[model samples]
Structures are given as C-alpha cells and as structure tokens.
Target: MEQAEIGLIGLGVMGSNLALNIAEKGNKIAVFNRTQEATKKFYAEAGALQSQIIPCETLEEFVAAIRPPRPIIIMIKAGDPVDQQMELLKPYLSAGDIMIDAGNANFRDTMRRFDSLKDSPLTFIGMGVSGGEEGARHGPSIMVGGTEESWKRVEKVLTSISAKFNGDPCVAWLGNDGAGHFVKTIHNGIEYADMQMIAEIYGILRDGLKLSAPEISKVFGNWNTGRLNSYLIEITEKVLAAADPITGQPMVDVILDAAGQKGTGKWSVIEAQNLGVAATGIEAAVAGRILSSQKAERVEAEKILGLPDTLAFPAVDGVAFLKDLESALLAAKIGAYAQGFAVMAAASKEYGWHLPMPTIAKIWRAGCIIRSQFLDEITSAFTKDPDVANLIVTPAFAALVKETDGALRRVVSTAALAGLPVPALASALSYFDSYRRSRGTANLIQAQRDFFGAHGFDRVDGVDKHHGPWGSGAAIY
Candidate 1:
C-alpha cells in the first residue's frame, strides 16, 4: 500500500475528527491511539473514508506508515501529557520529522518545547486549532508556529483542511516558536469577554426588564441579523429558544448560572499583565467566571446582605432603550476586541513574532467561536494599516466608536443605577475612557507614589524636577 502522507497520534474527539477531515480532503492519514481498540474502532467507523485511513496498532507501525520526513500531529492533552507523548514518539521519528502539538498549551511551554528540540534532528510545531469538534470534522481556523522550512512541508494539507472565509483558507504560519498558541490564547480571552458581555445584556433583559426566554431569544435573533452577527450571538439565540425535554423549560433557564473555564482565559490575563497592557474587559470576564464558581458563597452572601435597594429597573421608552442596548453591545464589543488585538500587538513585539494582524483578523472571520462579520471589518482596518498600534484608532473603528459611545455611556449609567452586574461592559467603557484621553488621573497617582515611596515623576513642563518635596504631609515645594 502507498505510504500515508501524514500521521496522527491521538483518537480523542478532536484527533479523530481531524483525521477524518484530512481523509475527506483527499490526504491519506495514518492514525494511532494509545489503545489498539480505539484505532480499530475509529477505522471501522470510518466506513467509506476507511480506505484513506491507516490504523496502526503500534508506534513503530504508525511511524513506518507515514512518508519519510514525516509530519505527525499529536492531538493529546496539553502540558505534561504532550511532553510524555513527544518523548514516546521521538524514538520512532527520524531526522526532519515534525511533531505538531495541536492543543491549548501555554505558549511559554510551547516555546520551551521548540527550543528543547532545536539541536535535535526532529522539529516542533505549536499549532492552535479552534472551532471545537464540529469544526475539526469540517474545517477550523489553524494557527501554525514553526520554522519556515518546516511550515512549507505541511502548509498544503493544513490549508486544505482549514475553514474558508470568502474562498480564502483560515490558516496561516504565524511565526516561529509560540506565536500560534499566543494568538489562540488571545482569541479565547476575547471570547470570554464577548460571551460575558452578551450574558450581561441577557441579564438586563431577563432580570431588569423581566423578559421571558422566548422574548430574549427574539432579541438575540434580531441582533444576529445586525451588527452583532456572530457565532456566539447566533448560538445565544438558539440556546434561549431551546426547551429542555425533561422540564419543558427554556434550556438556558434550567442550566446552572456558574460558568466553567479551562486555563486559556486566565493565561490571557496573566500575559496581558506581564506585557503591561490593560485588558480590563478580559480581566473582568475571567473574574466573572471565578466569582460565578463560588455559587454557594454567593447564595449565602446574598441571603445576608440582601439585594440592593435600587434593584428595580427604571421605566423608560422601551423601544428607544432597546436600541440603546444594541448600540451599547456594539461599543463594548469594540473595546474587548481592541484590547485583545493590543495584547497580540505587544506579544508580537516582545516575542519578535511580527504576527500578521490582518491575517489573524481574517482567519477569525469564520470557523472559530468568535467568528463574526465584525472581524471582517477588523480585517479591513488592519489591512489598511498593519501596525496601527491599536484597533480602536483605525479610521473605521474610530468612526464606529464615535457613533456608538453615547449609547454605551447611557446603558452603563442605567445598569449602575439599577444595581445590575455589567462588569465586562462597564470595564469596556472605562477602558475606552482611559485610553482616549491625552491627560489622565495618573499624575495624582504619581504624586501619591512619590509621597509614599519616594518614586520620581516626570514633569509635563519638561523641567528638571523629578521629585515632589513632601514634609509634614504637605508639598514642601
């Protein structure tokens, strides 16, 4: 039999589906699971695609089935498991063989793995695969980080199996080392903020306006047809509309309020802080999840502290306010996306990735959870000025902010007065406010720092004075 063009080392949901996708795309793939039973079952279930799948029972068999200078995808659990799997596979791989780590790994780990294999004949790739199981079986956005020569060896197959936006493949060789994984981390960070903002809007509708699930579903459906046309918003509509078969209640209504998270969101916040970038919206979203997990504590606290006195939503022009909510959502979304891109920009400089911002935006227009028409607009903005510092200052986005910021201000003010929790939205508003002003309250902070810690401060007048003379709790100057 002809040798398989590529090989895969895991048979979990993502791995199996990805193998099938490769087969469907006319690329013969050799697949092996840790268990022989899984490999056999996956091949048996492949049916028509089985002819393209070579299921191997041993690492030796799997490695021999692939062509020389092999590109093998290791779609196993991240961190320690990935390390262990790489060690196990290394014995079988010859010089020039590529091991692709397609998991949500911390980029620092990815960088170390790449550097560890630098002198070896084998090479490492840190690939970020987004869009979950369904996208894996069809196509997902693929971010590849490896040597340029190594990338060339696998680009065709990756492009063949990636999601397409306007007939363009949603995959790219971002840069060397951990660029792909870093971009993926920012993607998830933005996703957290996006979902939180949507949920905040839903909270206002359900709790403040006392709208039913069906009514809120209708609202989301309407938003999906407008500026907020995104996978998350589209799914939010469906999730609200769905009824649980057991209770015949709205699906979302029956589900627990607590949200669970893997580590990507936290990693994004940590990286942002390390980069000294203000990712307040993403930070608030992660905090929201952390606070959400403390359901028992929250329940007990609410019982003792009671709801805020001004808990009632103020009556207003329903139609006008609804419009305001829509505009507010758009504005908050801009803030979150801008912050995510800013984090990437900083990382690109710090790591010397020189990541293609326009390409990142382009790929995110489809396949990923955060896929949206808005990303197309972002793509356009970045395309015009690849190194524009921040996404919000782009001509198109600046105009958008100008048009929508008033509604955001109004919605935030209203939510505050009604004691509604809109941390992500409020953070976005504050981020925008803080970012735009040439002058800020930081001067007072500088003065306080100097007073307490004797830290020096810069003068606006370009004078030689660096210290604020303080004695007897007064400005001695």
Candidate 2:
C-alpha cells in the first residue's frame, strides 16, 4: 500500500473537515470511515486537488496506508468508541507511531489510555479541538496533551491547522496527561454558561421590555461594540434578526428556550464543587436550563402570576439602561471567569500540570465560540502576574468592578422587582460580594466549622487558641 503523510479516522462532519483542511495545507492524507461510502464520497469530493488524499476501505487499510512513524488523528465519539478505535488501529500501528484522540473524551479516560499505552513504543495524545465543524475545516484552537517527544512529532501538523490568536498559534502542548481534554471540558462548560447568560438577556428583553426581535437585535448589536462584545453576543444579534421562513416572523420566538447541555457543564460544576471553588455562574446557567425544561410550571407561572403586559424604560434614559445592563453582564462574566480559573488553578495543583491561564484566555479570544474582548484583559493580567489567584483581583478588573457595582446592583434589583430571573447576574454579584467581604461570613462559617470539626476559631484580633480537636467549643467573639 502507498504510504500517506497523515491518516485521519472517523470521516464524520468534524473529521472530514479536518482531513480536508490538512489536505488543503499541502499534506497527503489517508482518510477512513466505518462506512466505505463516506470515505469514497470524501475522496471524490477532494477531486483534482494538488494535495494527495486516498480513501481507505477499512481501518486496517487506513493504518496500512500511512507511512512508518505514522501520525493518526482519531475524531470518533468519546468513551467506549475511542477505546474500540484505538484497539483497531493498534495492530496496524508500529513502534514510534503516534495516535491522537481529538474528541471530548473524559480526562480520566485520557489518563487511562495514556497509562495503558505507556509501556508500548506507540505514543498517545489527548487533543482538544474547538471551533465546531467549520473551524475544523479551516483552523481551530487545538490543545494537546502528551509527552514532549510525541508533540514534537506532530507539532508541525497541529500548528498548520490551528488558528492564530493574539499573534500566537491557537495550538499548544497543554500539559502532560489529560490536560487537553481537561481544558476542553472547561471550555465547553464556559460555552454553556455564556449561552445561558445570553439567553437570559434575551428573556429580559422579551419579557421585560416587550421589544420585537429586530429591536432586541439592535440592542445586542450595540452591545457588541462595547466591552460586552463577544461571539455569543454577535450570534445573539443574528438569532434575533433571523426571520422565520414559514411565518415571516422572527425565528427567535419559534426556537426552544430550554437549552440542552452535553454533560460537560455538569462535569464542570461537579469538579468545581469538589475543589471547593465558587462556580456560581456556570452552576446557575446549568440550573437555568433545568428550570427552562419545566415547561408546564412556567406556563402556570405566566397564568398565576399574571405578568405585566408592558415594561417601561425611560425614553430619554436609554443610555442608562444600556450601561446598567452592561455592568450587570460584566459582573456576571467576571464571576464566570473566576469560577473557570479557580477550577484551572485547583486542577493544576492536583494534576501537577502548570497550565498557562493567560495563554488559555488568549486562545479563546478568537476562533472559539466564546471569543470576547474581555480576554485581552485576562491575557494581560496573566502576562503581568501569572500566579494571580483570580481575574477579579487584578487591578484593572477591580477598578472596573468598583465602577460598575452600583449600576449592577440597581439592574439586579430592578429585574428582581419585575419578576424576572437574572440568576447568572445575581450569582455573579453574590460571588463578587462574597469575595470582597470574606470577613463578613468567615465568623459564621468558623462557628459552624468549630461546631462540627471542632476546628479552633481564630479571634478577629489575631489571637489564636487551640481547642480539643473534634470537641465542642463555645463560640469566641
């Protein structure tokens, strides 16, 4: 069999797009799918391209089709299928060959796969591919986890197919063992939170202002020009403006409000809780979806509550509302990042993977779905001080928070009075307040801790005394 420079398995939407992308970048590729027809169709579509690409009849044929010291990218579904694909490719792969799992596999599974393949000469990589099918076809943000040697082998291919973020390659050797998927898991979690926040904004506009979709689209478009500018906001404008084909009405009304998450969001929340980090925004977003799914309860709410028909905003005070909304959104966004970075920090300590938080933020600035202007500030913060505990503590962010706090509080209070749920915004403010006033709740928590764990409480005046461990102690003022 003729040897190809690169091999790609699972010719699905993402796989096919990536394979084509590699081919376009002047690399010879051998492509395979479970179904022969899919592979043939892809090759046929490749047609008269300058870059050589061959379709393989089976997994065995595909493996044989690649050269010695081969590099194969697996784009199969996560979980059992990843293992099955690895098994199928193992026989045909030789020593020094490298295999990359480019799916959303659980980080634990990646760790297991890495351990299982450690003794063998073949190398394994868990890669995180972001930017959806289109990004895969062109250039996507790539996060890779493997040994430095394995990364060196396929680094060229990865760099060639990755997008540029802030003048750096979006692709990076994330860290050793499962870091790639771990980061991707968090990425998806952030995506879930971002989408939900935007949905909440849409609800506020629809239910509170009773604005038409086009009007809402205009508001979002204006938002995209400011600090709130982000991929989610950009898409929100499009979603609002899009007209329904059948009814000639805004499609936003026809779309389902109940968002469906694909588990990563849940995983992030669980992981955050385990690490004892406050992931209020992500958790609230996930909870918002659950609440949205209660369609019957919501219908009953509309009937029983008899929601106001019209919401009034001062005609001359448009800027005030926009500013207030922006402040609220910014506060919420900061809380979300705080939660995500806290997870990264804890995970870094646990896994011994020193992930560059700034680089992660920079990579998300473009190509990825959650790209935002705020990332520039995050990247700057990390550049200035890599070990900064939280983005909220950064001087610039702190100043911004101070300036926005009054407006954010007003907006949240108004939303609450109007019977609108702004959980993400409210949670963000709560996190901010909690962090800023840590001393306020520390006493109560210490009392509870002493009650349970018999942990000695330190006096606010810097006096410390040891009580019998796990023994009941009187509260010390």
Candidate 3:
C-alpha cells in the first residue's frame, strides 16, 4: 500500500493520459472521476503502468491517498465545473496543499478563482497544457501560473513530463494568477489565423488553380521540408493525401466544409477588443469560422446572387504561383504572430502578469500546434529586444517583409480578382499597411466624427482639440 505521490481528478482523455504520463515518469499517481466506471476502465487498460495507479473511488479516499502538502491536478471542464470540483474537494484538503487547473479556461476566471482561494491555505493555480491527445500521452508544452512557492513544489515533476525544444523543457512558471492562460489564449488565436491562412491557400490550390487533392498534398509535403515545417502542416499533408476508401475520393472533399471551434478563437478576438489592440487577423479568422458555419444560407445565397462558377479559374504559371503562394503564407503568418503577441503584451500590462514574451516563443517552438521553425527566429528577435512593440519592426522580420511583401500583395489582389475569399490573409496585409504608414486617412474619419457626433478632432500641431464648423458650429451635446 504505497501512497500516491499526486492526485489526479477527472479521468477524461487529457486527464487519463496525463496520469499515465506521470506514472510513466516513475511517479505513483492517484486517480478519480465523477463516476466509478471511468476510473475502473482506466486501471483495467493501464497495461504495465497499472501498478503505479492508485484507484480512489471517493474524494476523501483520493485526498487521503496523496502524500502531505498534496498536489492535485484537475482536468475537468473549465468555468462552473471547476468551481463545483473545488467546492467538493474543499472539505478534504488541508491548508498547504495546492490545486492546479490544467484547462483552456478564460484567464479572467482563473484570476477570480485564484483570488477567492486566498482566504484558505489551498493555493489555486492556472496552467495551460497544449498538444492534442497524442502529445498529452507523450509530452506537451506546459505553462503554469501560480505563486513562487507553489511552483517550487511541483516544478521538477512538470518539467520532466513536458516536451523539450532543443533539449530545453517546454514548461515555465509565468507570472502569478492568469498569465499562463492569457498566453495560451493568444497562442490559440495565432493558431486560428495560421489555420485560416492554410485553408485559404488550400482553397486557392483546389478551386482557383484546379489542382487535385493529391497534387496539393505534394505541395504541402514540399513546404514541410522548408521554413513552413510545422505540426499543422504535417497533419494537413496527411489529411489531404488520404483517400476515402468507400467513395474513392479525396477524404477532405467528403467531409463537411463547416469548421467548428471550442470558443478559444472567439475569446481571443473578444480579449483583443477589450485591450484595444489590433488583432484583425484573428478577428477575420473567427469571422471566417462563423461564416463557414452558415452552409445552408451560403448555398441558397449563391443560387440567388449568381456568383461565378469556380470552373473559370485562371491558367497561371505553376512554378511562379507556388513561389508567390509560399511568400504570401509566410507574410500572413508574420502578421498574425505580430498581432497575437501585441494582444499578449496588452493583456500582460493590464493584468500585471509581467509575462515573458521571449520565453513564450521558446516554449512554443515545439509541442504546441503552432510550433514552427518561425518561432526560432521569433525567440531570437524577442531575446534581443524583450520590450519590442511589434515583431514586424524587428530587423529579422523587417528583412523578411522586404523579401515577401510583393508576393503577399500579389496573392491578395489575385485572390480578389479571382473572386476567391482570403479574409485572414487580406486582414494581415491591411494591418501591416496601416502599421507602416506614417499618416493615415483617419483624420477624415475624425472630421466626420467631429461633424456628426461632435467628437473633437486634434489639429496638425497634435495639440488643441477643436469642434468643426458644421451648420451652426454648435459644440452642444
């Protein structure tokens, strides 16, 4: 009867594998679930690791099985479910024990939970775990947010279980409270933009260029050997290459066009808006997802509006077009990364998270869905100037922009003329253009605002706010 080193609640997919991951690391773990069945099933199929699992049917029993100053990791659904579990476990836990929540939860909620738990000795931690089911079983990127003392208690164990980027563990203790989740939310936002850009490229290949799925898959495979090498690209290649056995058609073609999300992408846009940061690429990506879901409406609308048939695709130079497409993807990817980190910077300031953006880039170099060769450059950029406002302004990225801006412009204009939608990619370019301009046409907008809404406009001196002469020249509200 060896006592377990840690307790894990929730025997769901993430929880079960994480527990096994802990067990595989030679740390005995106690596991529990809402029902007895999930726990029973876990142990029944635990294989060689069954001996390391301490099956606890009750919450009290689960707490009792863990060693003193217990470190309990909860993998339950975020929001209300976490509160429910906390309430249930409160009666059994002592003062010094810490509860770690490893979920894709909103950072604001995590902060509230962290604050509320301060009355007791139980420390509440908000952590982010990325990498899908397979990564969880093996090694995933980890971000933890808690007090220094709390991190010290379990730092070694978490570091040993996380994926390593060039021999460095992809786990770090960010600022106290919600910093980890804040960073993770931005990560997902960047992922959304990346996926949207990739999908747009796929659409261009399939519909605009009239390329076969296998042909497009070959292009993706080739790209994987270059700077675009990443987990998502690798999976996209596999998915596009796979053929449906039953229909003998491309597997992706038979699947529904609608994309579904679990709220993180939308949350990213909302948070960006709240921070008054320009994350237009993320906004466009989230909008693209919503637009994709209206399949029935789109079908009817297309019939009524008489959109051009996709058959009239332009005959373009294959080699030249692919080169431009690659450049466009890279440009758009840079814009998205810039915007996502901008949002993170704003959130860190507003919330006092003091998040280390460079370390974040380092951790994301592997394990995460957005892991890419691009991150190595980003890590180097941020390490050089940790307080850099925008990544596009960095020397490395500026050089990249100089190299690829034409191709990005070419692809966007081409897509527009070809009647293909490239919302995310277009937004990326628009944001970049707006950022680089010394003076924009927003003064006219301010004048319009002053005329209609009586909103004051600043003069050329960048000083005096003055009301414009509109009819009566009234400043009256």
Evaluated with lDDT, which candidate comes out highest? 1
Q: Kindly report which residue stretches of model 3 are placed more than 4 angstroms away from their true locations once superposed.
A: 309-311, 463-465, 473-477
lDDT string for model 3 (1-477, tens) is 788888899999999989999899888899999999999999999999999999989999999999878999999998899989988999999988989899899988989999998888899888899997877888899988988888888887788789898899898998899888888888999999999999999999998898899999999999999978888889899999999999999999999999999989999999999999999999999999999999999999988987765446667788999999998999999999999999988888998888888999999987889999889999999999988999999999999987889999989988888889999999988988999999999989988888778888889986675877678755445
Off by over 4 Å in 1: 472-477
The C-alpha RMSD in Å for every predicted model, in order, reads 1.6, 3.2, 1.4
Q: Which run of 10 residues does model 1 get worst, by summed lDDT? A: 468-477
Q: What does the lDDT come to for candidate 1?
A: 0.94
lDDT of 3 at 452: 71
Give the C-alpha lDDT of model 3.
Answer: 0.90
TM per candidate comes to: 0.98, 0.92, 0.97
The residue-level lDDT of candidate 2 at 132 comes to 93
Best by TM-score: 1
The TM-score that candidate 3 achieves is 0.97
User: How well is each residue in 1-477 modelled by candidate 2, as lDDT tens digits?
Assistant: 457888899889999899988888777888889888888788888866534787889778888888868889999888999899899888888999988899888888999999898899998899989899878988898888888888988888778878887578788887888988888888888887777777777777777677799999999999999989987898889988999999898998887766676788888898889888888888998898888888888899889987754345324256677677777777777778767988988898889889988888877776777778888898898899889888789898888888888877887777777778788888888888988885686777776777666676777667567443444344442
lDDT for each residue of candidate 1 in 327-379, tens digit (9 for 90 to 100): 99999999999999999999999999999999999888778989987898999
Which whole-number lDDT from 0 to 100 does residue 380 have in model 2?
A: 91
